[model samples]
Target chain A: MKLPEPIIIDPQSVPSLRWGIIGPGRIAETFVAATQKHTSQRFIAVASRTTGRAQEFASKFNIPKTFANYQDLVADEEIDAVYISSHMSDHFEHAMLAINAGKSILVEKPITYLPEEAEQIFAAARQAKVLAMEAMWTRYLPQSTILRQLLESGDLGKPELLTASFCADNRAVERLWKPGGGGIVFDMGIYPIAIAQEILGEPSSIAATGKVRPDGMDEESYSLLNYESGARASLTISGIATLPMLASCSFENAVISLGEPFFVPSSISLKTKDFYPEQTTWVDESGIAGHEGLSYQATWFAKYLSEGKLESEVHTHAQTVANIRTAFEITKQIGAKPF
Target chain B: MKLPEPIIIDPQSVPSLRWGIIGPGRIAETFVAATQKHTSQRFIAVASRTTGRAQEFASKFNIPKTFANYQDLVADEEIDAVYISSHMSDHFEHAMLAINAGKSILVEKPITYLPEEAEQIFAAARQAKVLAMEAMWTRYLPQSTILRQLLESGDLGKPELLTASFCADNRAVERLWKPGGGGIVFDMGIYPIAIAQEILGEPSSIAATGKVRPDGMDEESYSLLNYESGARASLTISGIATLPMLASCSFENAVISLGEPFFVPSSISLKTKDFYPEQTTWVDESGIAGHEGLSYQATWFAKYLSEGKLESEVHTHAQTVANIRTAFEITKQIGAKPF
Candidate 1:
């Protein structure tokens, strides 16, 4: 496939970056739609492991280019950034290839097979002068940013414990259950881990044990991590059973508890000893998009890129790596079978 | 000390069960009042290390006897049962003495220093033909019983995640920051742990970490535990901070959320997810108890005696032992100075 001319959002003014998705998964689709909607970013191309599937997705989405090979799509100079949303294991090689090709990249959470692998990809990105980041997305969300602000203001008092669980029975998503692709500790686990790292920092000790299933992949994993300051985090992730999927950080004086779907709670409540705690609601900020609550990450990503920022302090590379490291150690502790 | 004449509810009833208070503290005053209020129980004596204090408490409470030594109180035939609410380190000795005295015993929440000690007391109870149980009153509370009923009827769907936190600063209590006691995990943590165990059974694996003060006692503890069935419980307890000390259990379908002072919540809300994906408060059961919730535990103890039940199924000795064992293991893992 040949590189088509870049579709410029503001051709006569500032140049817009072209974004090509490497997989037609749900997240990739969401990313494409968001990019297509955002003028500062362009959804110019997409690629799937299967050419026919890629073409079908391209046709459905009305994209100009689609390729069967990831390497080919990434090599297309018209595309300045590659979004890798395939499987957990595929992340390392795809990220390495994109970094080697000098294209900036964003890989999904639990960015690599192991912490070492994440470090390798990061090193490659650094050595190659190409931007790379884990697509945590949640860190950039409005609620999360607000939460960070609340955390910084010292109003909640000294944070003592942060507990988070992100559980989904995605055994339904077979690609996840397959070897080297997906599993509970990698697929849904990173969200809670990342959230913990956001609030509690890197844990000094990690003790995790859970059922690793007959198929040799973790069906569910629970980890108790201790931070150096004695701050603690309990992270739970599963593909075996469904749960409330919550995130909570307890302070010395009070607590801030986020409701269901820790990834995107419809509402989060700040509660204390005061009688009857109610959730504070946020009015949607006027924007080009309709899903304001859901769109903050992408908008932040665009804003970060346009502003020439290296990384966000709230969701830094170190914390993302720390979160991934904790997940990796927990998976090993649970004896996740080698693929 | 001479035995006081039996105070029986009925002549045909069994002889009044004599009782001795191990700690002549504020709690002893309440226990004496309760024993006076209860028919089948007698307030035999009060004991303190200081002879003056012991006599002072006895005179103030109108007890028939006072002992400067706990061993003598435990040995008294006039005392058929022993209530232990002393410093935690003394519990091991006090309970051992009471058990040896062939007395029915009510040890506080943490039955002893560890699982083995609690087990020993259980075995002693069996050999001596005397009843022994952890004084976990929250389990016997009417609201907690209702919550258990709601849980059994599948009113909240499958039990999922239990988030319970109990935190209280003990600046008001003397000698609370001792090596064997005074921190949150053992002091305020037992109720929440018991509640989780009642709802979810024994966890197969547990990971816990907490804040240890300069004295090496745990000021805060956070634990993530996983049961065999993949149910998760995230529990946090602290002693250095002032918190609502509340608890809530989230299930697959609904959440059983409780209010502050979780040893007893003012209200419990059973929230179910509506078709709109919003939580509907299905049942909000809340109100002021005529008194503190611990009174419920005491009343339940009296009722159990009246009913001739050897062990309470609600807060069974076995369940309490198992939970304390978990707490003991957690304290060990967190290296909280054996407190």
Candidate 2:
């Protein structure tokens, strides 16, 4: 039994988009650097609220334009699209600003804090006839495409259970404990929840428990999603410890394990449940190690824009809404203050 | 840093007891076979509710006597101890009968269906001046001893999180779906719950969700346990699918993983979280494979009986009750019918 090769659109083959980046933080840096290095995407302008952070980011990336505020960046006619990489709390505002300006947008994971906000952003984007997509880069990775092919091939049969966790020690991040700041749920929990949504669709119900800091930020959480087909996904996220970030699904015929750091470029192993079971492992040889894989989403976004699509078919507007809705239910059940 | 060696008492050094078995089931065969082969423990009699079953088991194990009724087996003056491997629903009745007859007893895991029943069984044993221990054989494994020592030595530091799962495709086991059959909670769930109790102590609160069979038995479940010290354990159990049966604990200084099939003789890996992390893996070299490891608990029971202990210190009576109580809560929260 062989795993199928990923059908990837070469980055250079896709139309390049002149992009403006909002919120020049660490993730934004990775997005800009990786996209420029690996894809034909271009960064025309950079924006940051802080006085010179925009220029500093622009200088490092050799971008020609810089804006002190996001408004000017979105209004720039030279920018074809905007990548919103601000704090999760500001994703809705910046995404709305980009959508209203008729600029195609690629927002980071958790397009907005609330599902309703995501709906509003997509609604405005639809009205403006501009493409909008959540930069759920994991979906665009070559390994993920291979996984999708395997799932669609029906070799594994029906999925019965899924277990995934995203945990790390991030106690030093002060914003994580603040009111508008995305707590563990939005910041880290979205990965497992998004992947679960991608695999299981929308869950019928969610049961969750979590530990919250005195300041109302959740430090850790566990959410159990029950699907209509009786498939369950047990997900765990923590900001208090470093755990094995592994994800696996138990199907009727085999178990598929997405190797450690499952959200990144990793290996996939399929072990059949036959009497004489055969195990096959496929490792991502894309050579786009770590966050460099972020370039996949950038290139895909450019291709979607060139195709004149209103939303990404890979990580759709509906999926972004559903993922955040699941996260919302988890936050509500855990009794944490919502972002 | 070296892992601690297990301080195991030689089974031959402990005073051997003339044993009478209640419930001549598959597990009982394993218990009798492993104990007789590995330890000085001797089985004098066997009993089953079915007339020929006792005689069959007795003939197979080379026991001297057989009884169709448990009363006669417990009343046998030569029998010093009774090994109750009855169905979980009958554990309380069998254990109480053995305890009331002034016979030491080693009941199977999940000593009883409910915490109250376990309490009654332990109370009867206390009044009868006899030893009573839950056959939570995992605690007696050599790797478990090393895990305990690592936690006690302040090398792993304070445990912050635990994740464990005991899942398999047990749909063919008709008894698992029947009322009073113990379901998934009392059956496979006890393993992870018992280990969690050993490591994290009693949880202050539990949140759980599950899928129940049409017959009202739980087929799968997920539980989140919160401790007063802010530590947490996430546990999952299933009767519908075969899953990765891995257990791990995240501590302040290191993360320890009990390799697959963790409830039996397996490997232990300790990876420290220092600037330069060190990983050490230890495999059990005792050569006691699988069900054969059941003998360790029997031999330990013999030693505890010789020491005149009313309950095992390794898996205390209170610990058994607490573990059952946690399972009870899970069943209740998941809306499964109680056994």
Candidate 3:
């Protein structure tokens, strides 16, 4: 069986937007670096709670403006959109701040701590006629496009089972243990959960079990999502150990697997169920590696904005809300503190 | 860190028993072939429901006697022990018959569909002063011994997580879909569930969800087993797709993984969590491949019997019952037809 190819969009072909950064952190640094290096999108301003940090980040990223407060950044008329890289707990406030100012916004994932928060943010953005998208960068990668095409093609048959896990030794990360810090569910689990929702849609039911830290944060978890069509997904996430980050879907006629670090640019293989089975593998040839692929989301966001869209067509608002809802249900079932 | 080595026992060092076969089926053929080629254990009698089938199996294995009934085989004066490879639904009855006849028996996994049945079989064997062992087979592999030692050594720290999956396309097998045929839970899920129980012991609770076919057999399933020590296990089993049959444990200090086809003779790898992670892989060097490793369990059974043991020390009766109990709970949670 011939595997489908990804429909690659050149970053230069999209209309560039003057972007502002909120709560410039480590991930924000990667996002700015990747977008600046690979896409035509430009970062014009940055903001932090303190002016000193904002100035430092602005100087590092070669931005023209810096803000002592996120409000100032969102109010800046020179900025067309804001990348909300604030702490997960602040995503709702930051995103709404940008949307109220009529600036299109791309918020870091989990998008918000709860599904209700995300729904409110998107609803506000929709009413304001400003675009809002969750920065689920994996959804914009070329491999993800191929995966979507594969599922749509129906050549692999109906997907029966999906398995994905994200685990790493992040036990020393202090933020994860704090109340409202969102823990591993938001930090790592969202990747697999988002992808599962992307492929299998909303599950009919979910069963979850896990370990919780003394601080009331979930340390590790396993969730089994059952769909109405008899499709199932098994998701595992942890902050205490390093596990193979693999995502795979088992279909009636074939099995498609995304290699380790599945949420990033990686290899995808398809093995057909035949008397003499045939296997084919496709690897990323985009010349972009690791988190550098984050640029794809930026360019796509720009294209969506130019198209007069108020939400990402790839990672839609409904999908983001559904993913967070699944995570919320898992957190509740595990007896962990709600985010 | 240097990995520990498995302590292998030479089959010639043990006193062999005269074995009698009940329900000579496909698996029984593999057992006889592997044992005759790799161990000193001898098969003296063969039995099936019909005289013609018994004669055919007996002649193929060059056995001296054939019995058309399980009772006749178990009562044979020269037969020291019986290997029960009967239909899963018949395990309880066949095992009780052998124990009543004062015959040692190695029953195929699962030993019985329910924990209560297994308890009765072991209880009867104890009263009769005869050996009764569940032919888990995987527990006797050299790699399994090494895995046990690695866990006991504490080099991997307290095990925090375990993931194991067993999936294959067995939809074509008619028996699996039939009522009382034991479905995928008994046929395939037992391997991963037994190994999980072997490594983690009894879990505090289990949560399971799956797809049940129209005929009431479980088509696929996922389970989360939570332990009191904050350890969690995620298990996936299916009959609708072929999954990478790998088992792995993530520990505080390191991760140990059994390569694909983990329930059989395979490679083991240990990766330490260090600034510069160290990885070491050990492959099977005993020249035993695939089902050929079935001979290991037969040899171990002989050794245990010669030592005057009424149960396998490696996979104790308590452990076997615990594994079935886990499976039973999973089956119930998935709402599949009980065997």
Candidate 4:
């Protein structure tokens, strides 16, 4: 059994969303660059703690407006949605502010460091009748949908185990070791952990073991997730060790080896028992490449907002909170410094 | 930096030992079959609980003598060494018998399933002035030597993580669920755990989580071995799920991916930082294939005996004990039935 051709939705088919960038940081630049390059979405305003930084970002992105702080960006009536890419610790406050302002949101991966904070943000969004999503852009990629379809099709049999790791030499980065929301688990480990949750759902039990940096933040961590169905996922992420970003889902009769850096628009290979030695590689063919693939989520968000949906179906508000909640549990288990 | 060429020692160059078989079981058949087909070592006698079983084994292996009991075989003056392949529960008694009779021994793995038992067995062998070894045949395979050499070369840099799993669908086998030394962890998990200890040495901490059969043996297990150097090994084994037998060592700058069924003579791929996109695969040209590769350990044992060595230098007796101790810890943690 082969995966059906992925549903190729065109970015231009969705209604355009006027976006405002909050805390115009590094990831905000990539988000705006990708969305503007490949989608019908446009960033109308940029905001930063420093007026000069906001003006510089607006000048570079050719935005018509600049805000000295995130509060003003969420207040702009011309903005249909806000993209929150602030420092990790500020995600909850920024997201709550945007939700209460009645602006739709695409907060960066984590959504926030704690599940309770994520829950509050989503609740606020619901009360305001606004759209909210975690920018786990990988979930919206074409490859991810095909993977879900393949899994749901029962071609791979019962998914028994998933092993994934995402690590990099990021120990020198200051933001990764700050007082709050600073650590590899929040910044990097979340990718593998989120993907594991996406495939395996909630784990009945989890065991986490890891190392901490001199500053007491998590440096490297490994987690074992056990489910009632006997399915397990071994997830590892590191800041001090440069590990190959590999993700593989092993089912009863087949295996899906997602290529390195799986949380991106990359290729995937399937090896099924029926085919034995024969493996089929599925290419993304989405044409949008690299971080530009971030456009898919913006396009998806626009479609949901146009349909008056309060939350994304692909990555539900509940799933996002659960994912962060699991991360918090792992962080606590490893005795990682928390915000 | 590249790995040095693996030091190859010819099987035929080693002196042959006159060996006796104890218990005459399934793996014993493979051992004799592989050794006789590839090396100069000779099986002089066969032993089993029944005279008929011993006779049948002797006839198949062209042995001149057959004994109904292991004690008689160990006492035979013509037999210089004993190969113990009895049930896991009988290993300590069988090994002690051979050691007291002044015969060298090569016992099947787990070397008694507990660190204390292994320690006693080795101490007796040392006092008797005879060679004693656990048939961890994978350690003697050419591919294993190459992996060790690669790690030692610093080509891959400091080894930071190791991941391996060996799972099979053999739960229905009665011995696997029986009272004495029965369980997936003892019978199968030892392979991955042994190799993990091989790569990471003894871990400072180990965390295990999994399910148990209604019969009380471990149905599945996952272990995280944490080293003080911050290196870690994630090992998994199951009796219910048939997982790909994979072993990989991740270094700071590169990775060594030992091909599937890593506990065999197989290929290995090297991926380095400098040659990020270029992965080079080295195939096993040792010509020893399948169960026939078991011949390598027989040859190695004969060489050590001829050199008047009481133990193997490659895998020290202390390391073997530590490996079993870790397995015992994992088994207890998972609440699996103990022998």
Candidate 5:
């Protein structure tokens, strides 16, 4: 059984998008870098609460315009889309600002601090008749596309279990331990949970245990998601230990192991006893390594907008809501409040 | 910090023992093979329900005597130690028989079908003034000893999370599905649980979920063991998926990863930022691989007896009981009845 190749399209063939960057932080830098290098998406403007930060990011990225605040960029007529990379607690406010301005939007992961906020943002996008998507770049990677095709083909049999972990020593990051937009679950944990939701759908039951700092932010969490089909996902996130960051899907006849930092354009290998003791490692040679894979999502967004699409095909609005809803359930089980 | 060397004693220097096998099963064969190959321990007699099976095993292992029933072998005066490798359900009966016959005993993992039964056997042995232990051979291996010393030294900081998985495709094994001595938790899950207990001690709470077959045996299971120190263990077992069988201990300063089939003599590696990006993979040069490592336990048991020790220091009776009790808790949470 051959795994299908990921859909590849030239950056020149895709219609270019005039994007305004909201909140010029570390992730926004990567998004701008990926688009500028590999895609037709153009970051025409940059916005931060301070003009100095916005101007600095604009000069660094050679963006055409800079706005002191997000509202100005969202209201700009030249901006066709707004990519929200603000702190998670500010996602709802920024997304609402962009959607009210009738610009298409791509909000970063966790969509919002809560599933309800994501629902509100998408609902307003529906009313505005504009494209809306969570920039879950992992879903748009070549390896993820190949993995989805493999799973859909049933070549590995039915997936019986999946395990994923995303742990790093981010304890020194104050925002992670603060009350708002703080915690491993919202930042690091969401990736594994999103992947599990993508493969197994919503869980029938969830069991979770975690350590919450004295300030009420989650230090680490472990969750077991049990599906109706009896498939289980064991996921963990930490601000403490340095984890391998590997993800694996086990099926009746085969197993697929995604390499370290699995939520990226990394290698995925398949092992099965069908050829007993032989494993096939599928290397993703997209020439896009690490965060550079973020470009694929930008190109996808541009192509979807050109086709007048209102939602992402790869990460649907429903899937985004489902992922956040599971996060809510996980936090609830662990007794941690949403930021 | 340097990881300490394992406390190794020459197998040839250990005192010899006259062993009698109460059940000539597959595991019993490995025990006989390990002892014969590496230690001065002698297998004097073999016992099985069938005379033909007993005689065949005796001839293969070059034993001096064969018995159709366990009663005759245990009652034999020449046999000083008896290794019980029968099904889990038969452990209590076999252990009692050996204890009553004034024989030093080593029962295979899970010691008995129930923690209460293990307590009973140990109590009887104490009254009879004979040595008794659970042959959790992983504890006797050099890798396990080194891991223990590392944890004890506090060089890796405090352990905050441990992950272990021991899964195999054993659905075709009928005894694993039958009422007595059945299910993944009792058959395979005990190993990970034991190691976790050894490292972190007993947990304050446990949460578990799994799939049960039509016959009520567990097909797969996942558990979260939460300790008082806020440490957690994520464990999994399966009669379904083929898991990596790797075990990891994550601490504040470093991480220790045990190679696949961690319950065997295998390589262990240490990862820490102290060396920055360099990871030291400590390979086991014990010259024991796979089930051949079972010999280490035989030599350990002989040495303990020669020193007139009544219990294993590495795996005390209390620890054995604690391991079984955790298994009971896991089975209860998964709603599987123990055999």
Candidate 6:
């Protein structure tokens, strides 16, 4: 299984993974930084819809090469992997371009604006025998791994319920209110849905409700998911508000809750009946958020490419496909457009 | 308008409200301790369904009156109010007795376990001109009041979403699993649902899913509610297991989360989107569990009674009825028995 943990590479002795950015937007800039500091991942080049922006970002980031178009980045001979931080509506095209070019790809969240687009990307990856993963960053974070472990260990008791919300204060952000790739659930909800499935297993039934934007997208959505094991989850994500953005699991003997900065929290709690209710928090002792170790995801891609691995264990191709479909179902229930 | 703050009062300092208790359980003990330490309220009598238990509890707690039959306590002219903490199934009958006896009443959670009973009790309160309320402790907690203030004042921004769960480590508590009120939503889920309505206003529509026990009650429930303001909420509660029993609100700029012991939390967080993601935590300086001026609620009731106010603002006649009905609706959505 592909774990999202950062690889221990000696910066002075070991070579770094060569990753190229295929979109020079703000998220792309953050991707470059993550690839640079989160792991021993090197930024080889950058591509932008606009040549000027790509060249400027390349120069600012001190990358070795720049591409005027996404196709150029995918075909770059020196790039081992491509990070697709394109518009939500463009994920399918860019990811397919990079996969067919024989490079491992990391597509930004929502994977694609629609589930069919995600299916195409996955199918292409399977045909090309290249590594592909939907970048649900929270899945790769340390807090998430700890939560999964706690749930499996019976530390909190039998997992019975979970409630999560991944909303951002996106009301002031124009894209959230617009029809194309806008709305809180599409932008922020994907995380909670995916995480809920990862921890609680596939839901057997779904009940959802939400507030739709004037443009027909779900600006905010809430969903109740029921699993075959009788476990249930309540998940909400919105583009117009701020939520703890963390997942919580309840058990028969104890409770495990995530501590915040919501989306990027570093600590989680494990309390038991023996302790009655002891407050425990795990802070990031590594302080690696802005360091090369943060791009551990890029490093994982480099390994998969070199080792010829078909999929990542941390985020399997099957999981990504399922999650994207879940997002669509939730939206559909809330009276929003599927894309 | 009344604020929900615990008031510290000693019985000797002022006139005490004479009260009678009809149960001998942990929650009953809490009522006793809260009245003794937190409010200027006196336990004048106790009824335990039998002379042995009634005499034992009264002797243990130093009560001045003891009744083998619960009806005797209600008929006592000296008692001003009756606190009914008996089985949820008995609430309607017992409350009717107290109302006929002309005593004000405060009953345990589930508020009779039936919407019909809630309506019955509410109508009776109006007819008798007596103060009657459900002892939803969280509604009277400082955390809830503070949460309301934050929402009304737009501190974190408009409510984007709400996610709350209540699950107990019900390893040995079988009564909680009985037919009438033995599931998570009826037990723990109502806290968050009520809080959501109090803060975000009533939801226009709601969808729910859950695991139903053999006895016709849902053991666990997950519900999604959409408000007219374009806001949504996800709520869950269960007796099957422990997931982080938390109550969290996501707003436009920040989030506020709460959990056990929820009535008196150890800490709370307010996160805003500044450069550093401005996060602040408010931890209680006091180191007591559910002992944070809990007696104040009883005192507030006593004060209201003295002031000739039939309904205290802290626990209004209408809000308690609405909260219980909301719980009933959630269960109704899941195809479970409401009572």
DockQ of each: 0.12, 0.37, 0.39, 0.22, 0.36, 0.53
lDDT of 1 by residue, A1-339 (tens): 111121112322334667787768776776666655653466678888874878877877688898888888889989877778876778888888888888888787768767788888887877887777788876755456557767776777777667677655465677777778767787778888888877777888998877786778887776778878756676766674444566877676566766456565244556663433333544223352322233344455555566665554567677777877887788899998624
C-alpha displacement of B25 in model 1, angstroms?
A: 3.6
Instruction: Sort the predicted structures by TM-score, highest score first.
Output: 5, 3, 2, 6, 4, 1
Docking band of candidate 1: incorrect
Candidate 3 docking DockQ: 0.39
Question: How much lDDT does each candidate structure score?
Answer: 0.68, 0.86, 0.87, 0.83, 0.84, 0.70
Measured by TM-score, the strongest candidate is: 5
Ranking by lDDT: 3, 2, 5, 4, 6, 1
Candidates 2 and 4 compared by DockQ, better number: 2
Using DockQ as the yardstick, the better of models 1 and 5 is: 5
The 10-residue segment of model 5 chain A with minimum total lDDT is A271-280
Which clashing pairs does model 3 show? Answer: none
* Candidate 2 lDDT over residue span B1-339, tens digit each: 666777666888998889999988888898889998999999999999886998899899999999989999999999999999888889989998888889999998878778889999999999999999999999988888888888778766788999999888888887778877668988889999998998899999998888786667898888889899778999989888777778888888778878777898888888765322467888877788777889999888988998999999889999999999999999999989847
- Fraction of native contacts in model 1? 0.08
lDDT of 6 by residue, B8-90 (tens): 33334545879999776667886787667655678989998755987877787789899888888899989999988887778
- lDDT of the structure predicted as candidate 2: 0.86
What are the models' TM-scores? 0.73, 0.89, 0.90, 0.87, 0.91, 0.88
Instruction: Specify the highest-DockQ model's number.
Output: 6
Q: Model 4: DockQ against the native?
A: 0.22
lDDT of 2 at A262: 90
**Candidate 5 per-residue C-alpha lDDT over A178-205 given as tens digits, one digit per residue, 9 for 90 to 100:** 7666478887888999889878888898
Tens digits of per-residue lDDT for model 3, B167-231: 88888988778866668887789988987887778899998887787657898888888888777
